[model samples]
Target: MDYRMFKHRMVNIVERMKAIGGNVSEVMIGAPASLQQIEACEIKLGFQIPESFKKVLLEFSSSCNLRWVFPDEYQLAGELDGIFSGMLHWDLALLKELNDDKNGWVKEVFSNPDDEYDKVWHQTLAFYEVGNGDYIAFDLVDNSTDACVIYLSHDDGEGHGYKLADNFIDFLEKWARIAFVGGEDWQWLLFTSNAQSGLLPDSQSAKLFRSLLKLSI
Candidate 1:
């Protein structure tokens, strides 16, 4: 999408999310990094990320500092579709650190999402397992509005457990950290693709969300 169109949509979404108690500190339409930045990052990581994914880094960069605005609260409802398909979440402090041209920390944080893309919980959980031993999962959710949602499952046979993040950054940080680890037995999943399910209540879902929010902070 063009920057102008993207920015307008983002403003509308952010306002709506805020109405529902979402905490969105900053919004970016295109990749926050430049080409030279990405090249330097690739060298630091010792591998290349998918071009499709890199397109994201080339296009948009977003930061949702949930803690700053919410203090200790996080949204509970999960949206229907994937809001952060290409973007990655970076904390404000981290953003500055990574964005610094001298250190080139931003280049280093860019990572490939793993293959286990199936498991997620709108306003709850999401995961991915790259290969080797790298893995990431959303243990909880902080935001639940039109801007973003999550759907995840527990390993238990009953599918009785799941969680979501209040904002995209929360979700990204959870998974991104794991992807950065890179492992062989990494048997988890994380995805930024087209989400399949629509919004659904988890039966006592509000209670679960409130509980998770308290835990997230």
Candidate 2:
């Protein structure tokens, strides 16, 4: 999608989210990044950022306010809390710092002391941290202009990335559709609960909504 269309769709999605009475005010739109900033990130990462993903960072680095909600099954395990959260764009500086830092959480996943940052994270560019050690990143192994969105679960160990979407745009489209339109049975429950509870739904209901959304991630 072009910049205009992308912006339009995002506005519509945000409105729908507001209508559901969720606390989306923190879903602040970001200022566009300069060409220099984008270039610097590309040079440091050694891979061209996907145009769709770049457009989002240029327009709104972080577009939504979402928290990680673990499914009932994993609640006791406490292993899925950071698998996914709201889609937020990372600042260029943070992205570079994360990519370059050898002692960071990213390094924990590629803990082989012999592995360099580039070699360890070469095919992945982490743009969103889900906290604890998980991330939402672009998979560059295919070297595509529009890379696939993948979830890197630190708790799950290396070589176990979960595929989320074909590309950044695809992921956004699915998020809007699911969160706003309610495709599955559980999703409708979330919408209805939110409507009845007036945005701040009960903890159990809200947890369900968040847990279901994480499935999409």
Candidate 3:
């Protein structure tokens, strides 16, 4: 996927999010990282960062503060913060710190080598914390490109990791759709209610929803 196109699409999504009462100011999009900083992270982690993931970090090292415009009823409801929020993407420095062999949380979580789950964690790179100790990471063992998005849930006993998407772009696109358009069940409910209640003009809601839909496509 074209990085430029992906960035452009994300910018458009943020703008629309603002239109629907999202707190744009609360959103923290960090400055792009330098090549030196990127290389430092790679060296520290001992594994090459996927090109797709690196492209996103180069554009915005960290992004956060995205919230649902509507009330809880209209939201997907999860312990994790909004995907657009910086919470999903770690700062390059933070990523390195998190992967530190001696002081990293990864070591603590994967301490039991005998445990199967801990073994899986060994081959993955934990880039984003999904609150409650869960993480969104890259499954280095399963995908040769090391781009597949996976969810590692520390809280989930036994069976923890789950594949989220095939790549970072796919993950981002899904995140945008769920955030703006709502999930499979919620999307229809949100659109119908907003249109009927005139909370958002029908035409406007339809337009924004259409724009969001196209992003996923």
Candidate 4:
């Protein structure tokens, strides 16, 4: 990653997020930009990233704010797709239990719980090798719709990729080789993980909404 380039991109993203009313903070990763690392990523991933995205990466990596939103999952790595393959957490079992029953306690927690507060969950998991990368996953509580995105970098300071799905069912069928699954059921499973991961807590979640409110005002 090119520190100079990455720095430039981050500035842009921060400014844009600010315009959209996003919380920002400082985050740290150990490394400077290197050409060798970038080339290696391309050989591994077999793809190229658009110039527009590279600009975004430079900004996100060179600065901070590792945790922007609660529901977004950020995955950083030193290799191509190897980040997702690392230390996999088997939360599927717990997820399955939470989603199996509609009237279950877990379902209620995500639904009209706590004086009927409406909740929506979203996740972004960013995976990177040189600088920290992020991947995102998320879902809606009321309707239970889920989505995910994987951000990868390549060509040192020039190439990058972002893989995203509109919802969990789309991700499973289109990306994961799973088919014919009902959207509602799969979203419940994904949303359970979002809640369990603490990506969307009642307080922080409320704060984000407040932030949104201020933006609109």
Q: Highest TM-score: which candidate?
A: 3
Q: What is the C-alpha lDDT of each candidate?
A: 0.32, 0.51, 0.52, 0.28
Q: Write the per-residue lDDT of candidate 4 for residues 34-134, one digit (tens) a residue.
A: 44544454344343322322333333222123322211343222221111211111121122222233223224443443432212212122222222321
C-alpha lDDT of residue 108 in model 1? 38
Model 4 weakest 10-residue run by lDDT: 81-90
Give lDDT tens digits, candidate 3, residues 1-217: 5545545555665665555555443445577788788888788777788877777767645433343344232332232222222222456667765555322445766677578767656577776654555566777885475467665656553225555566776666555443433222123233333211311223444445544433332
Residue 84 shift from truth in candidate 1, angstroms: 16
Write down the TM-score for model 1.
Answer: 0.33
lDDT of 3 at 106: 55
Misplaced by over 4 Å in model 2 are 2-25, 58-87, 101-103, 112-122, 157-160, 180-217
Q: Residue 96 CA error for candidate 3 (Å)?
A: 1.6
Model 3 regions more than 4 Å off: 1-25, 59-65, 69-88, 100-106, 157-159, 180-217
In terms of lDDT, which candidate is strongest? 3
Q: Is candidate 1 or candidate 2 better by lDDT?
A: 2
* TM per candidate: 0.33, 0.56, 0.61, 0.24
